[model samples]
Target: MNLLRERLTTPGDPGALRAEEGERPQSHARAYQSLKMQVHQLLLSRIDLEAMENLSDDHLREELGLMVERLLAEENLVVNASERRNLVRDIQHEMLGLGPLEPLLADASVSDILVNGPQQVYVERRGRLERTDVSFVDDDHLMKIIDKIVSRVGRRVDESCPMADARLPDGSRVNVIIPPLALDGPVMSIRRFAAVPLTMANLIDFHTLTAEMAEVLSALARAEVNLLISGGTGSGKTTLLNILSGYIDHAERIVTIEDAAELQLQQPHVVRLETRPPNIEGRGEITQRALVRNALRMRPDRIILGEVRGAEALDMLQAMNTGHEGSMTTIHANSPRDALSRLENMLAMGGMNLPTKVARHQISSAIGVIIQANRLTDGRRKITSIQEITGMEGDVITLQEIFSFRQTGVAEDGRVQGYFQASGVRPRFQERLRSRGIHVADHLFDPGRRME
Candidate 1:
């Protein structure tokens, strides 16, 4: 222990240490990682786990900070105050949180964290991907962090499993794939949500949608119109779904089904159900389809599915058609028409064997609106199209455009230039909204009105 401490804290030229800027040299970084691991192991050896279980998170962090500072002082470490603080923080994170990910998770501006392997980490900030300097000591260190994350959520990943879907306590969605499947070492992606959920006003501020579109969507939610949000990955489908859910009646009983619970619905009377993966023995597996079927019996006024990806689509569609109006779910598709085709494919996956026409008819009847979200070439997420499912037209499901964002060109700065405009076709559901006393203005559907 003494030898390791001496090696880690050996004083270099005082001027050289003080002048260090930007990233540390490779040798210094390796030495720092070694020092952190030694301190982390020593701290684990000294702390009483049972006693720690009694401490609140804030208290535990404070106590750990003091202990780490004491250890550094005893070693006579020759690091600057900034380095000292970072070392203490890194040690604390190793003990109580996702080690190298703690800083990224704490950052409010980061929307996504992508870990390719031990040495490369990337983050999405403001819809742009940027590489980060954060990394793990090695593959083993990365695996430990992955284990900590999955174990907290009662999920597991290993050579046998090789994959897992989990979430942070803060509701950030986490996906993990390891070894045989990942090609590289364990790869994990975290889709982060805001500490405070984004509201419709926030979306409008971000130029994601217009105020008129927001009004129409709010009315759709209140009027119990089943909605399908279509988008590619990271195009803000879940965020928009959450904002729409805010418009749901507080008195109504809402049930949400998800593979992993990521929806932040703010209703007093709500039930959230998450699917369970098969255990090591390949028994006791619960799927979203089973949960959707079970949610039907709960007498929910509305059913909000996190995403429809498999056999669960049949049950979700049935729930919407029967009585659970205002139910919403998302799908991965580039356009509204493609979304319908995907829905049809998913219905087939359910093994109902309904003919093509019959399946199309079922979808046309159940879905009231399809809101297409897209991450444009310039990396801005916007609601590109909103189409109303206008029933069948001779074995085909017909759709009418209600509103859309037309991209004209990319600006010199590489920002996407677009205008959100109403398609001039007032929706058939406008009548339903009116019947429920939620009136949308006539001007909201006027084609002449364009918002940039």
Candidate 2:
């Protein structure tokens, strides 16, 4: 299609086999742009992107590559065999993969891929974001990429549905917001995870937690003590939840609920529930709270919510107390106390007009541990505080810090130096763990040596 539009248009320097238009660097770019736009338009008019996706990868690549070569030959474009193959792969990625953003997705270190507009792309690697040359040819090109993602997952995004949440093939979380709602042309953000989920040992290596803290959490999970992990946005809450949930007994049945199911729990007896958005007709919506209610009937030994947002907190707390112990959930908050506060607020959001005392009592009785995670300036995520919920004292829910990460000073290498030390206060549930046959070393709770 593009071959028809671009003429040989005055050849480049002698002996330059590349069909690129410009004699200088800038001219070569113009030629590439002209060539790419032609390919994009040609493929759209001749083939259905969705239909072609059904083909096997090898078949698709072979078929698409030949068509690109055929189109280029017709355009009288002159490129060596190597450039032709590269062009075909790029076109194939644009058609089958994420187009211009494909390379960024392939890079393991890139934790996030942010696109402000068609011409601007940024990626976060090693905790810092920097601009990259990757970009869409135009806004329409970007929308094509977004639509390709949403439609596959049975979602839609347009003027009518301008914003959407979707995940890529590799389980990378994706968000798409179009014009009118987006303000920019089309905004897309992708949050990628480690190819292999991090383990407690892995986190210990990263200094996210000490070996002793990890052991205590393992005992808490084994003891069936309900835990609520809290942190701000991008503070490693879900990652921590995934790591901690790994400690659940394999024989136990675990039910996990999420808006976009992202947990990769390895247990054999696990049932996963994902919330659904309202359909195009504004019907068939399933919410997290509804799922929590249904999970109780399914006989889940533990209910793990990806994140507790909104009215679901009430049901989750109720579920945790009603014979379903050791359940875990994540929430957005700054500290252990704030996590409780947010859970309370979410309980109110459920339209349960119970008194504050009643809600506090429910939280205090249901939750046994609060793990607060934080992302330091150097981009390391560490458990800042781990508090044990003793019970309600008056109208307040009493909590004692079991362990905390303290920043002694900055390191010479520019990395923030810190150590996770146990708090002298022993957890009230230590005896409970003992009853459940889960034990912790006594030295781990020595206040003078542990807390310091």
Q: Write the per-residue lDDT of candidate 1 for residues 252-335, one digit (tens) a residue.
A: 999999998999989999999999999999999999999999999999999999999999999999988998899999999999
Worst 10 residues of 2 by lDDT: 1-10
Which portions of model 2 show Cα errors greater than 4 Å? 1-30, 43-55, 80-83, 411-414, 447-452
For residue 199, give model 1's deviation from the true position in Å: 0.6
Error of 2 at 162 (Å): 1.8
- Measured by TM-score, how close is model 1 to the native structure? 0.93
Give the clash count for model 1: 0
lDDT of 1 at 434: 81
- Cα-based lDDT for every prediction: 0.89, 0.84
| TM-score to native of every candidate shown | 0.93, 0.90
